[model samples]
Target: MLLCFVDESDQGDFHGFAGLMADEHATKAITDSLNRTMRQVAVDWGIPATTELHGHPIFHNKEDWKHVPTRVRVGVFHKVFEAIVAEDVVILLRWVHVTRLAERQARNFYPVNFPPEQVCFQHILQRAQQVSATRDTYTLIIADDRHDRDRHRERFATYQTEGTPGVYMQTNLDRLLDTVHFAPSHMSRMLQAADMLAFIYRRVHTVTESDPRASREMAKLWNTLVDSGRVHNEGNWP
Candidate 1:
């Protein structure tokens, strides 16, 4: 079976001690690219294109999507996702968060809250572990790491040194799974979609950083959906 896994990171604008600073331009660009890919997928699947075709933004919540589940909302990957899940694949949408912290403490993870980046990654790894325990399939990770691959690698390395298990440390998952790396270029459909989403957020925050009123509103929206765990959902066990 082939599973098309999708993940999002830093949608709320909290980047390594950085506050709710969303890059709207990057987000918009990536959102558009994702929509284009979704459109193609929809057409290929013979699905009717409604006015809401690829209409949702890359970063959205239940408030934005009605047909899909909380975790897999309607967005760039929706078309192919809808088609594939019915047959040979299971679509897993893992949303990653990044935020501020006093230091790297693993114990403070369980009952995690918003504004903590490392904890979110830990939770993801934990979920992955649970998935592996029950399922016989492999996990494939398709990521957009053009901007901070090296930094992420270094961080992962440190985590390994500290005996912390993360997605990168999934040798068991790797045995059943393969990691597909896509460059954030105009060539790859997935990368293009990711770029559109990233660019949209980048532009929005860049131009409106100083306006506390608007920033506060965006932050509230982000925290309400993503940070509050309202949009985070898991699949049933086998």
Candidate 2:
């Protein structure tokens, strides 16, 4: 069985969905290693073990994140990235430029107005289906539980039963997802990894327009993912 951990990073202007797909047996080991590395970093920074390691706070320097020394923060960021890269994980991402989407809506490009979240979800599902077919294995999707969990669940159920509104015949639900599950991000290290990757992709794509340092760091991370051949991006809008 393949376990896919999914998360989203929606920064108003930029919205992205990311997933980490790995074999079910290897997922626990990967999460444990990540948690251990993060805990060690936290201890070195004098932060409590219970503290969450979110991407924005660690990379963008928010809240108590400022307490971590710059060098240590960068070290932890790279360490986490490297650890994730070292694992037998495949990264999949779907990015939507909200402004571009709004423009398309104004032009009436779509018969039905689809939310960015839904668009991202659909793309991820498509990718999941392709992966499942290629590996000939069942795939389970686990997403970070959000306030709109019920809404997402309802949408997913509809997709499974009726497919998407505009192109019902195009989506093959039966072969795609075995199930969709939700869990709190704090409780799932895999979900946390998805959050970081999504955050990095969003920040690198949008914030690089303004921040030089972010531009540099994002370039580095982007190169690492691309060069490793384990990451894929769907529908990146300029």
Candidate 3:
């Protein structure tokens, strides 16, 4: 089975989801290596090993990361990325533009509050199913426990038969397990990694950093992920 961990992020003009999927047997190794990387950062940076690692805090230097230098915090993310790359996990992403979503809403294509999170989640689920089908395996989605996640779980139930809404093609999503599960990011190293990736992906694509060097560094990390040959699919859509 493919165990896919997912998280969402929003930037100035885009919202998206990012995920890391690995064989069921391999997830343990990936999380273990990720824990090791976090612990090493804790040792070197003088923070608790149990401190949660996510993009905002580390990038913006908030909370436990605030005392650490910006360059050092970036190094922490680099270490985390190295651990992920070593695990050979496949990456997945789906992005939605705010303008496109607004236009759709204006045409009554989607409700005013219809979330881009749900839109991106549906696409990533479709991608996971494709991967699972080719490998002759089943998939399970584990997402960060955002307040709106119950809606996604309920939405996918119908998607299993009726197919995802507002898409050109029908994707019954049967290759995935019957439900979408939500977990607290603080408790899962894999989820933290997904959270960080989503934030970085959205940030690089949507934000124009005031500092050129800042933008370049974020783009570098994203390029590294793409160049690693593990990004099975990346979609930007209405």
Candidate 4:
């Protein structure tokens, strides 16, 4: 079985859906490695050892991130990225620029009621099925719990039963397991990694347009995932 840990970044101008897919056998090792890296980074930075690693704060300079020195902050970020890349994992992402989506809706080119979250989930489900097919294994999606947990769960159930409409040519219901699981970010290191991936990709595409240094740093990480042939993107809608 393959376990896919999913998370999203909906801040600022871009929204991103990303997940880390790893074999069930390797999941523990990957998460442990991530935990170790995070703990070590905290120790090195002289922060509380129990502090949780959150991508938004670390990348966007919020919360605990503001307390850490710039070099330490960047170091932790790179270390976490390296930990995931070193493991046997596949990163999956679907990003959308909200402004462009809104513009498309305003022009009647896209459905007004079809929110970016829905589009992102549909793409993730499709990708999960594809990954499951190639691996000849079943996939269980474990996503970061959100305020809209009930709604998201209901949607997943609907998709499992009815299949996704107006998105894929045909509904894929075989490879993915019926139920979607949710967990808090701090509870799962894999989820933390997923959060980082989504946040980094969204930040790179949305917020760094004019900042060359920021763009270079973000793009370097983003491109590494892109070159791995495991990450996928669903471009903006018409």
Candidate 5:
């Protein structure tokens, strides 16, 4: 049985990337740290980091994605994910479309077109069910902007009762496995890691840019940091 959690981030959406892009260096630094942390985790577990795991796609502009090589561009996703999760570990990935959610009155206050990546909640829900059907797995998904009271109220009122879109995923997974629990995303380290991983994944897998490259460079840098004993534990980072 694997106790896993999943979250998503979309670089293509304004709400998702606007603030991050406001300070390019800050965005790069945090993402760099993410890459670093994941690699260290792999190293601590005695796994070798490879280019196969390093190269990620990063789209500076969402509009450009339609022009990128879909096949090759999508390949980076496989590479990044292959490195993040071990073969024996069953990963539960949650998806939600932030743009669509924002269109609704309750969530409209949030930035739109932030990242189309977060919008794939229904897809992630289906994938989770499929994975759980064959293996013992558990995952909690967090939608961006879900931290607000209205979102929670909707979850309890509509989702919990009538079985709404991202809300009813638990029931769908229950048909396949015994355990399914949904919680706010900000609450879990595993989900936070998943979000960071997903963000790095977008940077490395979507477009060719220096920022994505920074993710790999940061991974190498962190390797040196760990070797130097600068970071003694996990809770020290953003």
Candidate 6:
């Protein structure tokens, strides 16, 4: 079995879900690796490593990371991504251009409009299902807790029973083992890892750094994911 832990990030222009997938047996090892990276960064930055590593605050100079220097925080961010790349994990990403989506909606696009959350999520689920196929196994999705948990579970149940909007995709999620599950990110190291990934994903794709040095750091971090060859199922819808 596979465990797919994911988190979401939505800027006005786009909405995305990105995270790591690990073999059922490898989750603890991956978590330990990530924790080690966090512990080192915490020691260096003078913050508790056990505190949740939230990407938005870390990158935006908010909360626990505010006292840390921008360059230091950026370096820490790079290190975390590096650890993720070094692990036995598969990276998944999917998003949609909401700015364009709104324009289409204004024109009275069919079915009101495409819901970014559901669309990107289903896309990722299908991708995870494909990954599961390689091992002749199944995937169980676990996401960072959100206010819309019940709603997402309902949609997932429907998709499994009735088939996902056939007009957009054709697979029926036979490899997906159960309805979506949720957990508080702060309580789960893996979910927080997903949060960091989703945050960087939004920052890299929709938000850009005005500082040249920081921009370079972000590029290097993304390059690590690309070069590692673990990044899979990445896409942005029109």
Model 1 weakest 10-residue run by lDDT: 15-24
Q: lDDT per residue, candidate 6, 140-219, as tens digits?
A: 89999889899989988888888887556567788988789999998887888788889888888986689888788889
lDDT of 5 by residue, 26-114 (tens): 32443354466446534544333321122222222133233445443344343334333322333332333344555662454544343
Best by lDDT: 3
By lDDT, the better pick of 2 and 6 is 6
Per-residue lDDT for 1-238 in model 4, tens only?
8888999887765677887888865688767876787677677766665566787787666776777776666666777777677777778878666778778678876544577887777778788788778778888889999888888888787877887766553565578786788899887878888888877867766674576766677777777776667664445443
Clashes of each: 29, 0, 0, 0, 24, 0
Task: List where candidate 6 sits over 4 angstroms from the true fold.
Answer: 102-109
lDDT of each residue in 24-82, candidate 1, tens digit only: 34334434544565565456544333213221343343222344443333333333222
**Residue lDDT tens for model 3, 162-194:** 887765546898889969999999999889989
CA-RMSD of model 4: 2.5
TM for every model, in the order presented, reads 0.38, 0.89, 0.92, 0.87, 0.39, 0.92
Scanning candidate 5 in windows of ten residues, the lowest lDDT window is 14-23
In the range 88-137, model 2's lDDT, one tens digit per residue, is 77899888788887788779766677777877777887777677777788
Ranking by lDDT: 3, 6, 2, 4, 5, 1
Global lDDT for candidate 6? 0.83
Model 3 lDDT-worst window of ten: 109-118
For candidate 2, give the lDDT of residue 67: 79
RMSD of 6: 1.9
- Clash pairs, candidate 2, are none
